[model samples]
Target: MQLEPDDSQSDRPVPSLAAPEFAAGDRVRMNALGRSRHPRYGERQAVVVRKVAANGWRVLFEGRTSLLTIHRDYLEKVEPV
Candidate 1:
């Protein structure tokens, strides 16, 4: 049997904190302070590509792979190694 989702609770997305602005090529690290964090991508340094939302910025991490949209609060500026 399949279970149905609860309709009583609101399915609206919770709003996150506003993110700081970053220019292209700014190095940053993902802070482990929020929800939905992956161990493989844990607190890794990334480069800011652009802003996707008021509190979300599109970043390209060190792996030189896919881009991720992370909230500003979860990102901190980091210096190059």
Candidate 2:
């Protein structure tokens, strides 16, 4: 999904938070915090293999590759590394 800046305020750019820091080859667990029709597998744990775009991160989970291109605001840092 393309992230378009809000048109209500043309003078100001779309405010965005800093992206979370997760390197490739890092293990991560993603939780479903919102409603969507993407998949019904619930929360999942996966390994970060590569980053596709500025806001898109590709993960390898259960021998399958899934693309999670989420906004930076929705992600939270986890411990237990």
lDDT at position 73, candidate 1: 74
TM-score of each: 0.63, 0.51
**Candidate 2 collision pairs:** none
- Residues 1-81, candidate 1, lDDT per residue (tens digit)? 999988776643345455456888899886665334556767668899988867788999897788988778777788667
**Model 1, position 10: C-alpha lDDT score:** 62
Candidate 2 stretches greater than 4 Å from native:
1-16, 34-39, 63-78
- Work out candidate 2's RMSD over C-alphas: 7.3
Which candidate leads the pack in lDDT?
1
Let me know the TM-score candidate 2 reaches against the reference structure. 0.51
After TM-score superposition, the amount by which residue 41's alpha carbon in candidate 2 deviates from its true location, in angstroms, is 3.5
Model 1, residue 77: C-alpha shift (Å): 0.4
lDDT for each residue of candidate 2 in 9-80, tens digit (9 for 90 to 100) = 864323355546677777665544311322543355566667666765666655555565543333333466
